[model samples]
Target: MRPIRRLLVANRGEIAIRVFRTARRMGLETVAVFSEADAAAPHVMAADVAVGVGPAPVRESYLRPERILAAAKASGADAIHPGYGFLSENADFAEAVVAAGLIWVGPPPAAIRAMGLKDAAKALMQAAGVPVTPGYLGESQDAADLAREAGRIGFPVLIKAVAGGGGKGMRLVEEAAAFDAALASCRREAASSFGDDRVILETYVARPRHIEVQVFADSHGDAVHLFERDCSLQRRHQKVIEEAPAPGMDPATRAAVTEAAVRAAKAVAYEGAGTIEFIADASEGLRPDRIWFMEMNTRLQVEHPVTEAVTGLDLVEWQLRIAMGEPLPLAQAEIQLSGHAVEARLYAENPAAGFLPSTGPLNHLRLPKGVRVDSGVAEGGDVSPFYDPMIAKLIGHAETREAAIAAMAEACEGVEVWPVRTNAAFLANCLKAPDFIAGDIDTGFIARRLDALAAPRAPSAVALSAAAEAAVALAQDGDGPWGGGLAGFRVNGAADPAVRLFLDGKAMLGSPNGMSERSVLADADGHIVVFEGGEAIAFTQAAPGGLDESSGDGAIRSPMPGKVTAVAVEAGDVVEKGQLLMVLEAMKMEHSLTAPISGVVEAVLVSEGGQTTEGAVLARIVPT
Candidate 1:
C-alpha cells in the first residue's frame, strides 16, 4: 500500500470540488485539471495547483486520458481521482493511470470492463445467482433476429444499446409494427453516444422504481453495502431527484437487494465506491420477488451526498482511505441508516420548453441557508455549452420522509436563479404533489404529470406586484431605493401609480393574479426573478406601450446555441404544422425544430453540422 501525498482530480465542476474537500480534510495536497473554458472555474480556484489540459470540448480535454495523465505528472500528483463523469468508468483510462505509476481512486479496471456492457453485465449477474429481467442478450445484430427476440419478450419491450447509459440510445417499442423504426433510431443514437450500434431487448415493467445500493470495498478483500437510494424521479432518462432509504421499501426487500449488491461487488473483487442499480416493479408495491438487477456503476454517483446524509459518512473521504489500501471503514452489520434524505438537482434548463438546455451567465443566484448546496458555479459565472448544465444540488435531511420532502420543497421555492431557465418550479411542484407526498412514485411519475409540472403558470398577484414594485424602485433610483434614501415615502390620496412590466417580452398590467397589494421592493438588475409558492416568475423592464420586437415573419429560430445534427426539410418543401425541420444538439441533448404553421419552407438557413446561436434563424417558412 502506497501513500498518496498529492492527489490530482481528473474532472471538473462540483464533483471536483467535492473530491478536493475530502482530500484536504485528509491532509493531502490537491491538483485540478481544467479545460480552457473552465480556467476560472471554482474547482480550479479551490485546488492547490491547477493545470490546463486542452480546449473546451470534452473529447479534447476531460475524456483524453493522456492529457489528464500528463497533467498529473506535471503537477507531481501521486494519485488521480476520476470523478463521476468523463473518464471515471472508462476502464482503459483507469488502467492507464495505474500504468503511469499512480494510484487510481476507483474500482479495479477489470471490474469496470465486466460491467461496462449492459448485456454482458446482466448475463454475469444471472450467472452469479442474481435475479434479472427477462431479455435477449445475444450477439446477433440482424434486424430480423432482434424483431424475433422482441416478439418472444412480448410487446412493450425496451430496445436498449449494449454500451449505452444516461437514457441515450434507448427506446420503447410498444408493438411489433414499430420495431424496425425504433431499432434504427436506437442504433443511430447508440452509435452517436457510445460508438456501439449493438442493442439488447428487455421486457419493460409498466411501473418501475429505480433503486440502487451504494457499496464500498477495500483492497483487503472486504466489502459492505451502504443501503439504497431511490432515483425514480427522472426526465428523458436523466435523474432529476434522488432520495435515500427508498420510500415504501420493506425490510425484506432492502435486505435481499443490498445483499445482492454486496455479492455483485465481491464477485468481481471490487474496491472503492460503486453503485448496483436495480429496477423494482411498483405496480404491486416493491416486492423482493419482483426486483431485477439493472446495472452496476463502477464509480461514485452524482447523488452520493444523500447517502452521506443518512449514513453520516463522507463517501469521498472513504474513497481516499480505501485507495490507500484501508479496510472497510464500517462493517455491514455495524452501519445503520439514520434518517431520510432527499436531493434535487438544480439544472440550467427549461422544463416548459421541452427541457431544452439553457446557457448564459447566472445573473442572480441565491440558495437558502437551510439546505446543503453543492455547486461549482457562482453568481456571474457562465453555464457554458461545453459540458453538462447542472447548476447545483440541494440536499435536505430529516428524521422522516415527509419532513425531508417538505424541506426540499422549501429549498426549491427559496432558491433564486435568473436569466438562465431552470426546473426549480417543476421540482417544487413534484414534491408538493399528492401522489409524490404519499410516496407513490415510479420511473413514469414525471412523464405522467409533465403537462401540469412543466406548464407555465400565471404569476400570482404577490409575484406580479413584487416585480412592479422592484421596477418602480429601480426607476426611482439608478443604484437602489436604499441608496436614494426613498424609504417610507408615500403620497397621500394619489391615484395608485401604475408600473408597467414585461415578462419575457410579454406585457403585464401590474395586476396580481388574485389581489393588488403594494409591497417593499428588493434591488433589481433591470430584471426581476421572483419565486413565490414554488413557482418562478421572471420579467424585465420594457418600453412604454410594450413595443413589439418580433425578430421576423415566419422565421423558425434556434432557441439555444447548438450544432445542427439533422435537416429533414428542404428549402422548397411544403410542411404541415409541427413537421420536423431540423434537429439541434446542445448540452448533449437533442432538440427538434418543427414547423409553426402549414407552410412552404422558403429557405433552409442552417445545414447539418453547422453551429448556430440562440435566436439565429435556422429556416424561413412562407405561410400557405
Candidate 2:
C-alpha cells in the first residue's frame, strides 16, 4: 500500500471542502485548485496550498484536466480527488491522473466507463444478475427502431437518453401518438447536453421512487453496502432532499436491494465511493422484486452526508484508504446502521419565482446552528452563476424518521439568506406536506403541488412588525423609546404612530417589534428584511404616497440576468392571459415568461440571443 502524503482536490465548493476536511483529519496536507470566480472561496481558504486553475468559465478552469494536473504537480500533491462534479466521473481524467503517477481516489477508469452509459450498465448488470428496469438496449439509434421498441414495451413508455442524467434528455410518452415528437426532443436535448443522442426505451412505472445504495470497495477484493438513501423528493429529477434507511423500507426489502447493489459493484470490480441508483415501483410500497436499476454514479454523491450520519462512517476517509490499496474496513455483518438521518439542500434560488437561480452577493446569510451544516458560501461571499447554486447542505439525525424530518424542517426554517433568495421556504413546506411527513411520496410529489408550493405568500403581521423595528433600529439612535423596546408598543399614548413600510411595493402600516422570535436585518440599501418560517421578506420604507414601482401592469420582465432565447409574438399581437411571451436562459436553465393579462403586445424590448439584466423588461403588453 502506498501512502498519500499530500492530496489535491480538483473541484470547489462544499465538495472540495468536504474532502479536505477528511483529508486533514487523516494527517494529509490538502491542496485546492480554484477558478477565478472562486479564488476567494471557502475551499481555497481552507486549503494548505491554493492554486489558480483558470478563468471563471468552467471550460477555462475546472473542466480543464491539464490545468488541474499542473496544479497538482506544482503543489506537490501525490494524490488527486475529483470531488463529485466537473471531471469526477470522466474516465479519461481518472486514467490521466493514474498515468501521471498520482493516486486517483475513485473507482477504476474501466468501472467508470462500464457504468457511465445507462444501456451498457444495464446490460452488464443483467449479466451479473442485478435487476434492471425492463427496457430496450439494442444498438439502434434510428427513430423508427426506437418507436417500434417502445410499442413492444407497450405504451406509457420512457424514452431516456442513454448518456443523460439530472432529468435532461428524458421524456414520458403515455401513448404511441406522442412518441415521435418526444423522441426527437429527447434526442436533441441528449445531443446538446451529453453530446450523445442515443436513447433507450423502458416501460414506465405507474409510481416511482428514487433509492440509491452507497457502496464501497477496495483494491483487495472486498466490498460492502452502506445501506440506502431515498432521494425520491425530487423536482425536475434533481434531488432536493435525501434520507438514509428509506422510509417504509422493511428489513427484507432492504436486504434484497442492498445485496443487488453490492453485487453490481463487485461485478465491475469497483472501488472507493460509488452510488447504485434504483427506481422502485412504489405502487405496492418498497419491495425487493419491484426495485430496478436506474444508473450508477461512479463517484461520491452529494447526499453522502445523510449516509455518513446514520452509518457513523467517514466515507471520504474510506475512499482515501481504499485508494491507498487497503481492504474494506468492516465486513457486511459488522457494518451497522444507527439512527435515521435526513438532509435538506439549501439552494440559492427563489421558489416563488419558479425556482429560478438567484445569483448575487449573500450580504446577510445565517445557517441554522443546531444542525450539521456543510456550507459552500459564507455571509460575505457571492453565489455566482458560474457554478451550482447550492448554498449549503443541512443534515439532521435522530432516533426515528419522524424526529429527523421535524429536525430537518426546523433547521430549514431557521436559514436566513437575503438579496439572493433561497428555496428554504419550499423545503420547509415540503417537509410539512402531509404525504411527505407520512412517508407517502413519489418522484412526482413536487410537480403535483408546484403551484401551491411555489406561490408567493403575503408578509405576516409579525414579520412586517419585526422588519420595521429592525429598520428603525438601524435608522435612528438606540436611546429612543422605539429602540429601547417594541417600537409600536405604547406605554401611555395612542397606537397611531405605526411605521409605514412597503413590502416589495405593497403599502402597509406596521408596528415595529423590537423583540421578536424571528430574525430581522436592515440591509445596506436601507431595506428591512425579515426571516421567518424559512422565507425572507424584504421591506422598503414606503415613499410619500407608496409609489407604484412593481410591474403589475403588462410588462413581462426577466427575473434574473440571462439571455433571451425566444419571442413568440410581435408587437400588437393579441395575447391571452398566461400565454407564453418569451423564454429566458439563465445559469443554464430556461425560464418561460407568460402574459399577465389578455392584452395586445405593445413591444418586444429584448431580441433573441441578446443579454439582459435582472428585472429588465423583455416585453411589454397593453391590456385590451
Candidate 3:
C-alpha cells in the first residue's frame, strides 16, 4: 500500500478531531465528512477539506458507507479512518473501502467480521483457547427455549444482543418470573437497534470488573499488546470513567491478560488497532487465569487516550504506518508502560436530574487548563439533540494511579461549563469516592452507588457568599439600575429590601449590596432590597425583585442544551411527582423528563420540537 497522503475521517465528534490531529502530525492531509448537523462542528473546521455527506441522523451521514466512500473519492483521499463509533466497526464498510482501492486505517474485513457478533467472537475465542464466559450461545431464538436454557444456567442470566453495543439490546433476568419479559424486551431492543433479534444468554457474574486490553498489529504479521484499562466505573453498562494499568492488577495477572489479548489479535490476523475486552471477577484480586474474553472492538475505542498515556506511544501513528504496509515498529518485549492515567467523559447532562441530556447554546465554555480536553464543539457551539451529548473527554496523567485520580478530580472541579448542564460535579464525586479511590470497582460500581452519585451536594455557604459578593461587585460597577447608590440606601428606611435569591433549590435573603443581614432596609414594593451584614453593601438592584422571584419551584432544570422532542403533558395536567412529563432528545438519546413534584402543571412553556437552552422553562408544576 502506498503511504497515506490524504485521509478521510468517516466519523464526527471528538474522535474525528483526534484522528485529524494525529494525521496532520504525520504530514497527512485530512478530509472530514460531516452531516448537516455537524457542518459547523470543530472537527470539520480542523480538517484540510470538509465534505458534506448527508443529513443529520447517523444513518444518513456516518453509517452510509457509500456516502463516506464517495466523499473520500471526491476529496482525493487515499485512506479512510473510521473513528470509534458510527460505522467504525462495520466489516462491510471495511470491505467496500478496500475494494475501492483505498487504505482502511483499521483491521481487515475478515477480522472485523469475525468479531462483529459477540456470540461468534466468543466461540472463536473458545476455539483459540481463550477463556470464554460460560453461557448459552446456541442458535435457538425461541423465547421459551431461551428461558429454559437460562433456567438450566440458573437465575441471574444476562440476555445480550448478538449484534450491538452500548448496553442496548441487553437485559438481566433476575428470576424466572422476569425471564420472559426480559427476553422479549431484549429481543425488541435488539431488533430496533441492530436490526437483528438474535440474542445469547450469559450467566451473569456479579461484581465483575470490566477490563479491556488494547492490541495493535501491522501488515507484516507482527503484533503487540498494550496492557489493559479499567472501565468498571459505568452506568447502564456504558462507561463513564476509565483508567489504564487497571488499579489492582498484579504483574502475573497483567502478563497473562496481555498474552491472551495478543493471542486473540493474532488469531484474527488483525491489522491496525483493536481492543479485546474481558470481564474479571475482582471479588478476588485479578488472577492470571480467571479472566474471560468478552468481545473485541474492531475499531478505535473512545477511551483510547488512557492507553496512550501509559504506553507513551501514539497508537494513531501505528495505525497509519500499518495501513501503509509497514511492520510493527516494536516487539512485545520492547513495549513499556509508565504512569497511570484517568479519563472522564464530560457529557451535556444533569446528574441530579436522572442524567437527562441537555442541549443548547454553550455560553462561557472554559475548559480546564493543564488537562487534556478532546472536544468536538466550542464555546458557542450548540450541543445538538441529533448527536452524542458528550462535550469533551477530560484526561489526566500522573506518576501513580492515586495521583492520577486526584488530578482528574481537580481538573473536573476546575472546569467551568456555564448555561449548560453537565456531570462535572458528579464525575468529581466519583473520582473522590472511597470505593473508587480504594480500587474496589466493578461493572455495578456506579449503579450500586447511583443514589450517592446523583445526590446533589449543596454548594457551600462560602460559595453562596462568594456569589453574593459577585452580585455586589456587579452592582457597584454602575451596571445596576440604582446607578447613584441611593437605590439601596434609604433615609431611615423602616423595612429592609427583601431581595430573594434562589440557589440549589433554596431561597436565600440578601441585600442589594450582597449583604444578607437581617438589618437591611427594603422598599414598600419589596422590589428593592438592601443587604446589610454590618458591612458596606456592594451591589445595587438591577431590576425589581418580583420579576426575578416570580420563577416557580426550584426544579432541577435541563443541564445541557437540547430540543424538546415530545411534551407528554399539558397545562393543568395533574402528574405524580417523578412521572414522565416529556421526552427531551439530546445528543441522540431520548431523555424522559419527569415531574419534580406532585402537582398540577402550571404552564407548558415548551412544545414538541421546540429548541431549549439550559435553564429555559419547559414546564412548571404547582403543588397538588
lDDT of each: 0.85, 0.86, 0.78
- After TM-score superposition, the amount by which residue 545's alpha carbon in candidate 2 deviates from its true location, in angstroms, is 9.5
lDDT by residue (tens digit), candidate 3, 392-429: 99999999989999988887876555456678878988
Q: What is the alpha-carbon lDDT for the whole of candidate 2?
A: 0.86
- Residue runs of model 3 more than 4 Å from their true location after superposition: 476-499, 510-624
Whole-structure CA lDDT of model 3:
0.78
Q: After aligning candidate 2 to the native by TM-score, how far in Å is the CA of 230 from where it should be?
A: 0.5
Clashes of each: 2, 0, 22
The TM-score ranking, best first, is 1, 2, 3
Clashing pairs in 2: none
lDDT per residue, candidate 2, 12-54, as tens digits? 9999999999999999999999998998999999999999999
TM-score of 3: 0.83
TM-score: model 2 vs. ground truth: 0.90
Model 2 misplaced stretches (Cα beyond 4 Å):
151-155, 174-185, 471-475, 478-496, 513-515, 543-556, 563-584, 593-612, 616-624
Candidate 3, residue 22: the lDDT equals 91
Task: State how far residue 558 of model 3 sits from its true place (Å).
Answer: 11
Per-model C-alpha RMSD: 3.2, 3.6, 7.3
Best by lDDT: 2
Cα lDDT, model 3, residue 521: 23
